[model samples]
Target chain A: MRMPVVRTIIGVLSLVSVIVTVILGLFITPPDVVQGNLARLLYVHPPVAWVAYLAYGVTSLASGLYLWKPTRSMRWDQIAASSAEVGVVFTALTLVTGSIWGRPAWGVWWTWDARLTTTAILLVLYLGYLALRRVQVSREKRAKRSAIAALIAFIDVPIVHESVNWWRTLHQGATVASIGTNSKIHGIMAWTLLLGFIAFTLVYVWMVILRYEVTVTEDAIEALNISAWTLERENEIGSLSDEIAGLLSDNKDRTGTSSSKVR
Target chain B: MISESIAVAIKDLRVERRSKVGLNQVLPFSLVVVLLFGFSLNTQSRVLTTIAPGLFWVAITFSSLYLISRTMRLERENGALDGLFLLGISSVSIFIGKLLALLLTIFVLEVIQIAAVVILFSVHFESIALICISTILATVGIGTVGLIYGSLASDDRLGESLVPLLVLPILAPIIIAATNCWSDALGNHGGLGDPWLVLLTVFAIVFLTVGVSSFGAILED
Candidate 1:
């Protein structure tokens, strides 16, 4: 399962696919009839957002499995942490790209549109999840606490979306701002988008594998360091005890008395 | 279980009574926020009334942050939380107990806030019944979610900051729904008709279930 060769192959393939995707999406694809070249951002933005969502979904699912009694393991915790880190990165990218795309389309750098606002909140929620993991605690305690937090956050997402949507409707009242998706997307644009999705998903897979490997290695190093420190402490204690015994013998010899009486 | 829950709630209320932290500190902080909002806006009475719903909820939200930290601090100090575990009481009871106590405390805070808003801003609520229902549901929702995050962050070094970060984003729906419900009750936009209240109710139910079910796991050391 820890196939570095396979991971490298996937990583290289992802790079190639992404490069091809960028070229096809930006240069080769025909411009949209309405939004001009800005429509090309559609190729990059949605896939990245999709990957962010996918990553968070995986994180929450792994966390839930870890919390369940029958399936609990350190592996699930590792998966949850690594996936969430990747998810956070992609979410940040999603916001940046979405803002860039929005500025020209919406005539504003940021709008309180439902999807955009919810995504911003999503970023904060997972960022908080990452911060929760950094709190110093026992592994089981950290995992257990974060698993529940993750589940709660996941459950809140749809509700967050719903409330934001309702609030947007009440305030804005039918303001038309295209948030990436449209029913009219077809032909080469659709193909490019599909490629974008595939390529980005591959990138996600590659990143998660490498990140998980790094986590496992780091855990091993920490374990080894702890054991080595304990061994060194034991050796120091052994030598100190010998020195004390020697001192006691010297006292006995000098005093010409039983050591038992001193004890 | 009910007795245990009530006992824990009483213990928390008794502790709060002795400490007076909520009464003296948090309540005054909220009133100050209300006053600060008025000063910052420096607008007409109508404008103050217009934004009163948002101001009231924002004040409640911030003060709830204070309330949760104080309540959790009571458990953290002197290993009192460990004492609870040692007593072999169920974590569900502990959760409900703390939740009930928080709910009551927040209710009182909201009441004072409502009074302040009505007095200082000269605002009149057209529908007291709807306002009461929305306030009760929203308070329960906030209390439930607040306690969950409070327990989650209680042991962290950066807990005070982290709890608000975790709680606020999740509480966004409650804040929105409650604000809209308040607007409706105040006849701001001729009453949007029951959906906002339903949303608030749903939020309360979801978090209540989540808190009750997961409290044991989160409280495990």
Candidate 2:
């Protein structure tokens, strides 16, 4: 009951925010001094990257909580799985948008920049996490394995960033796509970026909630099916014994002389 | 715990000796990669020296996939992992033992790789000490993390195919640091202090600790 209402509210809020974000990002915001129209991608690309990172961060936190003894629950596992699934999607979007933005800005489809490389690695790491979850195992084992994998992968994030930075600095190559916040973004552009972040975050929240609900329903159906199968098997066993007892009685009736001899 | 770890390590070494899989299979695989690189690239050109560091690390990384999978496969055979758990041995000891064995095997593989690189690529070493230290730290880091991921992936039906997906991304830092450190040692680039080496050491310690502490959680049913 509560789920449907909350989901409805989130659905309405997300739709409104997304529409507003698109309008401001595409029409109202002014182009950059240098990048001009291509800079408009800044609104969507950075915010999607932010949400992707945010989703993975949530997954790591939920996984850590699930691994800890006091806070262990199926709720945490569900959240971890839900957020990871969403995180992988957003991560793929981040890579694709980053590539799209790079084509116009950097004059190439891809460059091994620190942020791009790190984001690509993040995508792979979480994809591996998702793949690990698909193994046919008991629920508890899957949860534990995935939680540890998430933590291990999370630890690599900072290292990947630092290493790529070190590599780039060593080569002394100029970073073409300057997406960092240090750039002088002002007025309508800044507002649109902020709105983009808010809208995407809302979208992520809405998606995760719906996905979690589906996971819960799937788990319930699986449990109900297992119990139904068990009940059916028990009934079959009972009927089998009844048939054996009937056959024994029929044989006893046919061989009444044997009963008298035994007496 | 220390004795148990030693016992496990010795047991793994003995198994490797009897089977000779690491020697006959993984080492040759590493050599073949180096040879393939030599063949694909113009060995006569100076470009070989310039790209040698990257090539060397790539070979090591690829070979690690085979070694990790082999290590995990040895345990998977005959349900040996379950037997180890049923023995009530500390999971940390098992992890440490596997880490030790992998480190030793990888170090040997690295030594051979270095020899092969020098003979084939004609790399002139500027600083032997830096290269050796980085190799040791990076090997430890790779070994510890590889063992953990190997165990995790071995449980899955995908088996060896899942290992690289789990490992290579996590190993990005080590590979980068190692390649840069080697570049610096070869005098291809100016010295950038010891930051990469420090990163390697830090990552090695962090991974070793994580692997040790989390082994029990991952290994249990």
Leading candidate by TM-score:
1
Residues A197-263 of candidate 1 have per-residue lDDT tens digits of 8999999999998999998898889789989999999999999999999999898787776655687
Model 1 pairs in collision: none
lDDT values, one for every candidate: 0.89, 0.86
Question: Which runs of model 2 end up more than 4 angstroms from their true locations?
Answer: A169-183, A242-263, B42-45, B86-88, B188-193
Could you tally the backbone clashes for each prediction?
0, 0
Q: What is the lDDT of residue A36 in candidate 2?
A: 93
Give me the candidate number with maximum lDDT: 1
- Docking class for model 1 is high
Q: Over the stretch B145-215, how does candidate 1's per-residue lDDT look in tens digits?
A: 98999989888558657888899999999999998889888874534357898899889999899999988
Global local distance difference test of model 2: 0.86
DockQ of each: 0.82, 0.73
Model 2: C-alpha RMSD to truth?
A: 3.3
